[model samples]
Target chain A: MRRARDPFFWGLFSGGGMLTALLLPALFLVTAITAPMGWFGMTGYEEWATLAGHPLTRAGLLLVAFLAFFHAAHRFRYTLYDGLQLYHLDALISIVTYGVAAVLTVLAAALLILVV
Target chain B: MKSQARIPTGRISDPGYPRASNPEYTRHHPRWYRRRMPIFWWLRKLAYTKFILRELTSQPVMYVTLFLLGKMWVLSRGPEAYETFIQWLSHPALLAFHALVLAGLLFHTVTWLNLTPKALVLRVAGRKIPGWAIVGAHYGAWLGLSGAIFWILAGR
Candidate 1:
């Protein structure tokens, strides 16, 4: 039997959700919470630039950003469908949802590559 | 046969909503009107409300991802550009937004962690691993990753 394409998006959603759940909060703690609060010595601009400049770190950041975007797109799409009762527009909604994620992922990749 | 004859045959009382033409069938199995799902159905149940909130947390995660990307773009421009971005983060509105996002992130982590075990079914030597063990493994991974990132950023 032919399978639906839904499993592919579901896989991306699950992978992205797992990564965001596991990694994002810690990132928020350091960058948004602790660093700003002066809990530890403020990280110098050079250090952040160096980390962002590293190829491996840049790649990891890009993966995180992309996965998070896809996960959000999937969730938001369902929210609009079930919560808001827009099931009639599922085709348009899926296109807009995943399309935005794809665009952002491309933009993120471009920016990451451009980082020096 | 007499009861069937007494029943209406040709048309239903409410033309807008049709019923079975057979009176016996209609009498035996009454029409069921399914209640329409309310737009605010999530608000009706605590579990549903939590589920919706967890889903809503995705928005902030998306926002933060965009913010991080923007930061990287500014950083590529030079130290002056990055400094300008940092200064922009100090705005009260932006700070409040970050705080809200942080709360959402926390909620996302907790709920996601709680749900992880449901997705993962582990078996060892024909014996199923306990649910708590699966949950524990996820938490362990989370702590290890968080610690690793912290050490990378702060240890040096």
Candidate 2:
């Protein structure tokens, strides 16, 4: 039988993204639990706004935002297409989901530039 | 659409012949799609746009990023810097962005909350955890975090 479009690539990409999302909570949990105890050899910045001045922190935040946005966009698009029986509008749905993801990437970048 | 044409019910006396072929299935226009192709296309695109916008606006990245950055800032300098940063977050422009991000965050939370059951397994004794339970947990977490922040700042 002739093979249609390959689903393997997308399956891998999306699966990896979901794994990242699942891991994020663990990081957050560790931070929350350890922070109060002062175990990580970390010190607080003098001002909360200082994060805006720090390039690494700002960039990391933006990266997280962009990834999460794109991941959610992809998942939601498929959920709608399959679960909701939206076969006819699949192309339009794809375009819009990607569009939103792109805008989110832009927003995250803008935030990083302005803040960092 | 004839199944008999595709499926050979072997009637050979010798019964030694084997047949293999890809069968053709009927293509359907699902009544609704047939009558509303143009309008469906337009509405479909519009709905697609809405979904995309919804996902983009409600990213968890925004909140989690800000929170982590705040945590990191506190770590680098001390509580003082973090406090100052929090205070600065209320700056007119920053606050405006905050408002927008908050709206997005809420939208994301609400929609994803509904996806809890399908996305994750929370079974017990061969029974699955109710979606409402998952949603309630999130709501509780959100409230708890809000309260903690409020308490910390109010006390300080």
Candidate 3:
């Protein structure tokens, strides 16, 4: 018998949910909000570039991106299914949402590994 | 005879004909008179509104992750492009949107962490751990993780 995919995706979803909850707020605070506002003397581009390029940081970012994308896809699936009552379009909806998540995860891996 | 009427006789029957033709299947208050839900039905109650909002908060988390990927993509284009990314981030409109996204993400954190006790049950000896301790541990971990990130990003 073929293995079920639900539990695998669910594992990713919950893992991503947990990781995102723990770390994303501070990341946003530093990267988008305070750093953009130039607080804490976070103006230097070279430092960020260097920090991002580190092997460890790139790996961490990739892990976060990979899991977070799946988490989003799973939640978005249920959101549309129940909230908007779009259960009739289950196959189409699942394909679209999870497909987007997969595409975005690949894009993230590319950016983190090849670019940054 | 009534039991004979109730029991199956290995006969095929019209699918909808029986139920539809029943004497009690009145048109005035048909059992099938399900209330058609509007598209925005979740707006009816505060609990539903919050539940949907929590579900939607995942989108912002996804968006922020995408934003991070975009930042890396921008950095690949050289210093000028990176600067442009920062400049775009500094715009009032973009800042406002991010602020809202931030709020959504924070909500997701709080809700998800609080809900963890249900998902992650732990027992010590024969007794289960209390919900508060589990929640507190999550909060504690969140703070520790947040502190490490800030230390790395904001520390000189």
Whose lDDT is greatest here? 3
Count of residue pairs whose backbone atoms collide, per candidate: 0, 16, 0
lDDT of 1 by residue, B1-156 (tens): 856554545565634224445434443667679778988999998999998898898898897787777766776788788667667776778788888898998898888889877888888999999989888889999999999878887656
Tens-digit lDDT string for candidate 3 (A1-116): 11156888788889999999999999988899888888886567888888877889889999999999999998899888888887689789889989999998888787777767
Predicted candidate 2 versus true structure: per-residue lDDT over A1-116, tens digit per residue: 10135254244324425433333443443334333333343323433335336676566566666666566566666656644567889789878976877786686676566544
User: So what's the TM-score on candidate 1?
Assistant: 0.83
Docking class of 2: incorrect
Tens digit of lDDT per residue, candidate 1, span A1-116? 11256888887888998999888887877776565444565466788777778899889989998889898999899888878888689999999999999999998888888644
Question: Which 10-residue span in candidate 3 chain B carries the lowest summed lDDT?
Answer: B8-17
Query: Which one is best on DockQ?
Result: 3
Better candidate number, 1 or 3, judged by TM-score: 3
Clashes of 1: 0
Evaluation by lDDT, superior candidate among 1 and 3:
3
The reply for model 1, stretches above 4 Å from the true place, is A1-5, B1-34
* Residue A5 local lDDT, model 1: 66
Stretches of model 3 off by over 4 angstroms after superposition: A1-5, B1-33
